[model samples]
Target chain A: MIGRLNHVAIAVPDLEAASAQYRDALGATVGGPQDEPDHGVTVVFIELPNTKIELLYPLGEASPIQGFLDKNPSGGIHHVCYEVEDILVARDHLIETGARVLGGGEPKIGAHGKPVLFLHPKDFNGCLIELEQV
Target chain B: MIGRLNHVAIAVPDLEAASAQYRDALGATVGGPQDEPDHGVTVVFIELPNTKIELLYPLGEASPIQGFLDKNPSGGIHHVCYEVEDILVARDHLIETGARVLGGGEPKIGAHGKPVLFLHPKDFNGCLIELEQV
Candidate 1:
């Protein structure tokens, strides 16, 4: 079963501005920025009492956020991360039901330091979903 | 303060089909369909262990889902709802800090029978946010 919502990610053109808005304007506790070179993006987490909001920005020319921001100039929600009891079990179940796991069908170390897998958006009716093992 | 992640709303072209996908395929407990005329959408709640997923379909000629579905024909995540400890406090803080509340800044009765308010998509970096009093 899906445990809980881990975080919701938004692709932003300017990470500092987005982080500042959530911190200064919303009065939310904001974490410092961190670069995930493997993912080709830099991110800052806004700490909400319920769940975290991840602000993603391109870290390099090959960053995927570059493409997402190119299409949505004003930035937008990119994806959501939900916690799962066991990622391998969830992965097998999703595959058994014809859900395609992205990134070569293996889990990766996500921003939360948990094993995470991405499911194909087409399989989930056009919404990209991330499952993280808790 | 936000209490917990309440639910995530997804716009769907076919409510029954989407509900079935989550139920039979994802092994989730699905609830019966509900007509929310005030919101102009019919929704089905998929019960996950920690949170719920709301599948929404247009209910009338002027339903907002019609436009969202028109843009994303295959359907997609529409908005996310988070529980707030106090609705009025959260609203006042958000407004005072420059967040635009939707529907004239009044809390409406949402699907979960709670007082809910929607924040503007532009304010929080293009994510339509719902704050529910819990």
Candidate 2:
């Protein structure tokens, strides 16, 4: 079973500005500002009591975040993450259900080095879902 | 400050069917299948470790869930809720920032008797946000 909610990812045009607004308005502390060269995006995390909020911004012209921003325009939720006991099990279950795995392999270290993997949004009716094991 | 994530609401075509899908797929036990006569929605709750998942289906032709489902053909997330220490404070803060309050006043006892209020989607970039205090 999925253990708990890990975080909710939000796609933003500018991570810094979004982070500042979230901090000032919600009083959430910023955790990290890290880059994912593989995905061509930069992400920052804000920790909350039961879950974290991740702000994502495209790092390059070819980044998926840019496409999402262009499509949504208003910068809303990008994905919802569920913490799992085993990433491989979750990935396999999703794969068995014909869901496309974004990373195409076992989970790798994510923002805080926790094992994480993302499933394609198409399979979930336009909602991106991520599985993480800490 | 937002204390935690209270729930994630999904607009579905059928509450019972969606509840079954979520229960069988994620092994989450169903909590409630209550009706909101005010909003014209029949909602089901599935409790998780730190948050709840709410499946909402329209009760009448004028229900907002119908409009949401009609707009987004493919079923997707409807709203993400944050638990607040004080619903009035949170509502006031959001209203001061020019966000329209859907309920137009202090929160009332929502499902399970918690104070809850929803913000107008137009203000939040098409995302329906709910503030709940439990």
Candidate 3:
């Protein structure tokens, strides 16, 4: 069962600029500015009362953010993460339903020290989704 | 300040099919099958622990869902709703910051008996967002 919304990940052309906009314009507080070299991207997290907002920008040319930006032309909502009680169980359930896991192995630590995994958009009718265990 | 995530609205070609899939595959319980004649769509709401998932299908040919489906093709996440303490204040803040409101008016009762308003995606860099006062 879905627990709660953990965060909404947005792909931005510039993380710093977007982070500033969210903070100054939306009355949100920034939680982080972290770099994930493995994913070829950098992120800034904004904490909300019940859920957080993560702004993501490509760190390199081959990052997925670049591709998403190319397709949408404008930065937009990238994914919605749902908090789960157990990452492994959620992962298995998703896989059992023929959903493709973006990463080929077990759930790993994602941005902000949370265990997470991604389900491909292809299986969910073009909605990229993240499952996290907090 | 934001209260919590109220729901994530998804544009879909067929609400019944999508709702069934979510219920059967995700083990979620359905909360509503509502119609918003003004918005030209019918929606099905699936309640989660802390947030809800809304599957929207156009009721008329000129409905916004059709446009979104055309733009994304395979169907995808359309918008995220954030719960707020006061809808009027949030609306004023967004407008003061030069963000456009999709429907120019006060918060109206939306799906699941909540007062809500929408922010145009054009101002948000391609992300339609809703604000609900719960």
> Best candidate per TM-score, number?
1
Candidate 1 stretches greater than 4 Å from native = none
What is the DockQ of the complex in model 1? 0.55
Which model, 1 or 2, shows the larger lDDT? 1
Cα misplacement distance, residue B88 of candidate 2 (Å): 2.3
What is the C-alpha DockQ of each candidate?
A: 0.55, 0.55, 0.61
Per-residue lDDT of model 3, residues A1-134, tens digit only: 66777778888866676776677666778866788887778888877776777888888768878988888766999998887888888778877877788879488887657888888886676788888897
Question: Candidate 2 regions off by >4 Å?
Answer: A97-109, B103-109, B120-126
Worst 10 residues of 1 chain B by lDDT: B20-29
Question: On residues B40-85, what C-alpha lDDT tens digit does candidate 3 reach at each position?
Answer: 8898887777667888888876887788888777789999887888
CAPRI tier of model 3: medium
- Model 2: per-residue Cα lDDT over B28-104, one tens digit each: 67865888877778888877788877777778668877877888766678898878888888877776766688856
Q: Give candidate 3's fnat, 2 decimals.
A: 0.60
Candidate 1, residue A30: Cα displacement in angstroms equals 2.0
Q: How many clashes in each candidate?
A: 0, 0, 0
Candidate 3 lDDT at B30 equals 80
Each model's lDDT: 0.84, 0.75, 0.78
Ranking by lDDT: 1, 3, 2
Q: Residue-wise lDDT of candidate 2 within A2-96, one digit each (tens)?
A: 76878887887666766765676555678667888776789988788888878888886798778778987767788888888878877777666
Residue B27 of model 1, lDDT score = 65
